[model samples]
Target: MSLPVHLAPSLTGVAPGETVEVTGDEAHHAVAVRRLRVGETVVLTDGAGTSVTGPVGSTGKRVFTVRVDDVRREPRPQPELVVVQALPKGDRGELAVEVLTEVGVALVVPWAAARSVAVWKGERAERSRAKWQATAREAAKQARRSWLPEVAALARTAEVVDLVAGADLALVLHEGADDALVHVDVPSAGRIVLVVGPEGGLSEAEVAALVGAGARSVRLGDEVLRTSTAGVVAAAAVLARTPRWG
Candidate 1:
């Protein structure tokens, strides 16, 4: 069975036989909640491609130490997958972020589309962004990912257009589009960006702006998906065609 993975702030220079300390909420969860005990094996990651596997050497109420047995550093996955998700109403925004992170999206941009029902302003915006970041972090650990997906700052239409313009392949999920996702050419390397509209769907002008920025308007299928799910399905479709999934 695979050992449970925990996140650390940094695992740089961690080596075999070294005693690494884990503190704060992370260690508390492992020790108190998960009942992690001395001599139990666990994996720690910095979530930036550095991981260390070790056995617990000591346990405290809110801290634990691991005796490192192995260290592994992975290169970031290439042909990166990035999703521009229009903010979904209520908790669906977190739902979208969680699934996207688990599916290996390298970056997630929370977009404020014209038709979006949700608004993130001032304190609410900071809290909402924090929620997304926390969700992605937990989901990445659950998926045993060495590289954690980044939750970018909430973006406006213009900012999203810049991302679309810079991607090697950019696709906008539109039910009215003529092209299907399966038919799009997947690049072997560099970045691929997918844009998912809000619950109310993308406005005509929004579609035009994205397309004008070089994104190909494409459809996932005949059945319409919810804002929280469309990006996950579209990302999986694109990733399947890339070498990362092969």
Candidate 2:
């Protein structure tokens, strides 16, 4: 079984035999909720590129210490998988973030597409974005990922276009498109960005804008997928064709 992982702000220069302190909510969760005890083993990650595994040395109300046994630093994986997901209504946004994080996406950009149902504005937007970030955090730990997938702020179509323009391979999911995602060439060392439309689907203008910015409109298959689930399926397709999944 994989040891439970807690997030730390930093794990720089940490080595075997050293003791690392975990505090704040993470510590509270480990202590109060998980009831981690001394001698019990756990894994901690900086959520950047470093992780450590060790037995718990001590525990307090809002803190715990781990006697470092091993330290592992992983290079950022490539080719990076970035998904521009249209905001789905209700709780589906968090669901999308969770699965995408587990599927090993490097970044998730929540887009406010022309046809999106859920609207983000003012304080509601802030709360929704926070939920997405929190969901990604817990899911990454559950997946035992050393690097957390970044949940970017909600993006507009114009911003999404800029992202698509810069990626080595960019794909926009469209059921009407002729190209299939499986047939796309995925590079091993560059960014692959996939755009998933809202439930109502992308507006014709949005499709024209993205395709004009060099994104290829592609389809997964004949069956349509939910906005929340399409990003992970598309991400898996890209990863399956790359060394990252091999």
Candidate 3:
């Protein structure tokens, strides 16, 4: 089995023969919950580009140390994918965040679309964003990714338009569109942004605004997918054509 991976603060200057400390909640989970022990090998990443592999050196109640034996710094993936995901109802938001991060999406933006049923207001807004971020963090570790995907703050339609306007290539999921996702040209550099609508689907105004901002309206196929799964499928399609997936 592959060694378990844990997130570290920063592995920027780390090298072989160094002892790196793991502390707080992360250590407690690995030690108490995962039953990590001395001499066991584990991988650690700063969730940026640096990662290391080492064996446990020591263990305390809420902390542990690892002897770094290998270090690697990965370059950022090409054609960075940023998905504008309209907030879904209930736990589906986290579900979307999870798969997006696992599939190597660079960023996930929670969009508040006009047709969205779930609303993020006041405390719930803060809490929902936290859930999405937490879900991404866990999913990155689970996928053993060298870089973690960022979950941006909740975005309004206007903000999303600005995002779309700035992308090298942008796409919006619309079942009614005549364009097929496979036919769209995927860029090999810069950002490729995709917008996944909510369960209620995108309003006509939303589609018009995004299209006006340079996003092409495209359909995956004849069968429509759930809001939670659409982003990942679209992301996978985009990645497939890029060197990142080659």
TM-score of each: 0.98, 0.99, 0.99
Error of 1 at 56 (Å): 0.4
Model 2 scores a TM of 0.99
Task: Give the worst 10-residue stretch by lDDT in candidate 1.
Answer: 6-15
lDDT of 3 by residue, 72-121 (tens): 99998888999999999899999999999989999999999998999999
Instruction: Extract clashing residue pairs from model 2.
Output: none
Q: Which sequence of candidate numbers ranks them by lDDT, best first?
A: 1, 3, 2
Error of 3 at 85 (Å): 0.5
Candidate 3 — which residues are off by over 4 angstroms?
A: none
| Model 2 per-residue lDDT tens digits across residues 33-97 | 99999999999999989999999999999999999999999999999999999999999999999
Model 1 alpha-carbon drift over 4 Å, by segment: none
lDDT of 3 at 8: 84
Cα displacement (angstroms), candidate 3, residue 77, comes to 0.7
Point out where model 2 deviates above 4 Å.
none
Between candidates 1 and 3, the lDDT winner: 1
Query: Which whole-number lDDT from 0 to 100 does residue 53 have in model 3?
Result: 97
Question: Candidate 2, 123: how far from true, in Å?
Answer: 0.7
lDDT of 1: 0.95
